[model samples]
Target: MSLTAPARLGIQLQPQHATYGQIRDAVLRMEDLGVDVVFNWDHFFPLSGDRDGLHFEAWTMLGAWAEQTERVEFGTLVNCNSYRNADLQADMARTLDHISAKGGDTGRFIFGTGSGWFERDYDEYGYEFGTVGSRLDDLAEALPRVKARWAKLNPGPTREIPIMIGGQGEQKTLRLVAEHADIWHSFVRPDAIAHKLDVLARWGERVGRDVSEITVSNELSRGRLDDDHADALYDAGVRLFTLGISGPDYDDAPVQHWLAWRDRRNDAVGVDAA
Candidate 1:
C-alpha cells in the first residue's frame, strides 16, 4: 500500500542528564533543522540510572522552549495525568498554547498524556500508580473533563490544543486512543504496531469514532531501525514519527535523517498524487 503524506515529523529532546545551556542550544539547532515538533519527557528525575541525576521540570522548560524556538511545536511527549488535576492540566495547556502562539499562528502545543507507569515516580511524588487498568480508567475519565474545561476556559485553548495519548496496551490504552486521542503514540515495532492498529480500529468501531481521524505516532531510535521500516509504518497509518534523543547535546545526526525521511515521505505523496 502507498503511504499518505505525513502530517509532520517530530523528535523528543529528553532533558535528563543535560545542562540547561546545552538544551537551549539543541532546541535552537532543531528549529534550524526543520523538525515539526520538539518534545520533552515529563519527569522530575532521570528515568535511567542514578536516580538523583540532574533533570528539569517539563512545563517550565516548555515555557522556555516556547520563547527559544521559532518554528518547532513543543510539548511533553506524555504527561502523567495522575499527577495533576484535569482542570489544572487544561489551564496549563491553554496558557502554554498562547505562549507558543505568541506570534499568532494557531497554538502548536499537543497536550500529550497517559496513565503513568513508573513506580518510583508515583511513590516519590505521592501519586497513585495503582494497577495499569486503574490508571487507564482514570485517564479515560479525565479526558472528557479536560475538553469541557478547555471549552469553558477564557482563552479557550489557542486553537483547540490537540490531545495526544501515549501507550500500547491493546485492551485499554488502544481503546482510550480510539475514544480520546487526537494522536496515539506507541513504541512497538511495525508488526506489533499493525496488530495494535487493528485493535484500535475495533475499539473505534465500538465507540462510533473513525480510527483514521486519530494520528498514529511511535518512538524511533537514532538509526537503529531500518529505513524501510518507516514506509512500513506509514503504510500502516502512522503519519507522525518521533525520534528520541538525550541532551546536554542533542545530536543533530539522528534528526537530520528524520528530516530526510520526512522529505522522502512528502515526495512519495506528491508522486502518488500525480
Candidate 2:
C-alpha cells in the first residue's frame, strides 16, 4: 500500500454569527498563517447553543473564499449533500474550481460532503429527514451521480476535486469512504480510530482499493487534543487534522497550539516540504 501522508494542518472557520466582512478577512488571515486548507461547515443556521442564530449558506461564501484567498485550499468541512441537487453541486464545484484557479494553476478545492444531519434544515426547507440509515443510503446513491455529473459538466473542475467524506459509522460511512473518498474526516478518537481504520482497510480490500490513498482525518478539539493527545492521533495515522473555531469574533488562540503541533509534525514527517 502507498504510505504517503497528507499535509498535517487544516482550519475550519465556523460561521458562528459572523459578518461577511469579518469572515472574508479571516479567510485571508488563515492563508497568511500558512494553513494548508481552510474549511467552513454547511448549515443554513448556527448549530451551537442558540439554534435561532445568525449564519450563512455554504457555497456562496465558498465562491467568495475562492476569490479572496490566494494560497490556502478551501472547502466546506462537510456540505450537506441532500440540500442541493447533485447536478447543481457539481456545477458549483466546477465554477469554484475555476475561480480558485484564476491565475492559471490546478484548482484548490476539495469537495467535502456528508449526508444532511440537522432536522431543522430539513424541516424548514421541506426535505425529508427520513431515517439516519435512509440518509446514508441516499448519500451512497448520490455520490456516484455527483461524480458522474462532475465529469459531464463544462470546464470540468480545473482539476480533480478531492472528495472528502466526513462521518464514522463503521457499517455505512467507512464503507462509503473506502469506495469513494480521497480523504475521510471523522470524530473518532485516536485509539478508537485505530480500530475503525482497520475496518476501513478491510472494506478497501473488499473493494480492490488501497486505504493509503485515503487520508485519515479527525477534529482538532481544543478541550480534547492536548499536546500528548495530538501526538497520539498522529501516531494513529491521522495526518490531516482540522481545528474548528468560531466567528462574528474570530479567535485563533484555541488553535495556535494545534498549529504549532502541525509544524512539529511537518518537521518530523516531511510535511516541511509539502
Candidate 3:
C-alpha cells in the first residue's frame, strides 16, 4: 500500500452452492482478471445459505486447481490444523507446490493455515473437536513439524512455499506468526490493525526475529473495499486485500470493482514520484 510493494488482490471463491465445473470456470475467470491469489476455505459444509448446500472439499479441489490454471497462487484460506496429520498436511502442501509448477518455473502455492475452528467440520469428519486452547497448542506444535517435514520431503518443494497464518490471537497466534509466518492474514478493523501490529512486533522481539518484512494481509467483506477505511488499512501497511465470492453465482462484480481500485492505488505510486 505504501508502494513499497503493489497491493495484491486475492479472492476466496467460496466452494458452495454450485457444481465443481462452475467452480473451475470461476477460477479461470479470476486468473484472467489478474487477481494474485485464489483461496478456498477448509470446511466440510457450506458456511452460508442452506446448511447442507452443495459444497466441495478443499485439498482435493486444490489438486485440480494446480492443473487448471498456469498462473495465480492457490491454497486454503486457512487450513484446519486438526483435520489431518501435521506431516500429512505438509506432504499435501508440498505435492501441490510441485503440481502447480509449470513451464519449468517455481510453484504457485501459499500454505495459508490456522488452528482449526468450525466444530461441525471436526464433528462430522471424526476429528477431535478439542477446546480452543488445545487447538491452538496443537497448531503451535504442528508448525515446527510442518517445517521439519518439508526438509525431508523427496524433491522438496520447488520454492520455500510462503506460509500465511490466519488469526490474531495475541498470545499463541501472534507468537506463531512471529516465528514462522511469511504473511499474517487477519480481518481486523482499521482502528485495530495498528494495535495488532504493535502486539506482533512485541512477539517478534520476544522471538528475536525481525517481523518487519512479513506481509500484512487483510480481508474485505463483500462491498466494503471502497470505504474510506481502506485508506486507513493501507496506511496501516496492509498490502494484500482479499474478498470472498460464493458459488452458484460466483458474482465477480465486487472483484472487478476492487481490482480497479487496486490499479488506482498502485498508479499513485508513479504519480508520487512524478
The best candidate in terms of lDDT: 3
Return the TM-score for candidate 1, rounded to 2 decimals. Answer: 0.92
Better of 1 and 3 by TM-score: 3
Q: 22-100 in candidate 1: lDDT tens per residue? A: 8888888888888889899988888765678878989888888887776678899989888899989999899888888
Put the candidates in lDDT order, highest first: 3, 2, 1
What are the Cα lDDT values of the candidates?
Answer: 0.82, 0.84, 0.90
For 1-274, candidate 2 gives per-residue lDDT tens digits of 2234644678888887788888888888888777889999998878875777678888899999988877788899999988888888888888998899857788898999998789998999898989989999989998898899988987687888999999999899999999999999988888897788889999999989988778888877665657777778778888788888777767766566677778877777565625
What candidate 1 gets wrong by more than 4 Å, as runs, is: 1-3, 222-225, 271-274
Writing each residue's lDDT as its tens digit, candidate 3 over 220-243 gives 766555656677787789988888
Return the TM-score for each candidate structure.
Answer: 0.92, 0.95, 0.96
What 10-residue stretch in candidate 1 is worst by lDDT? 1-10
Clashes of each: 0, 0, 0
Give model 1's clash tally: 0
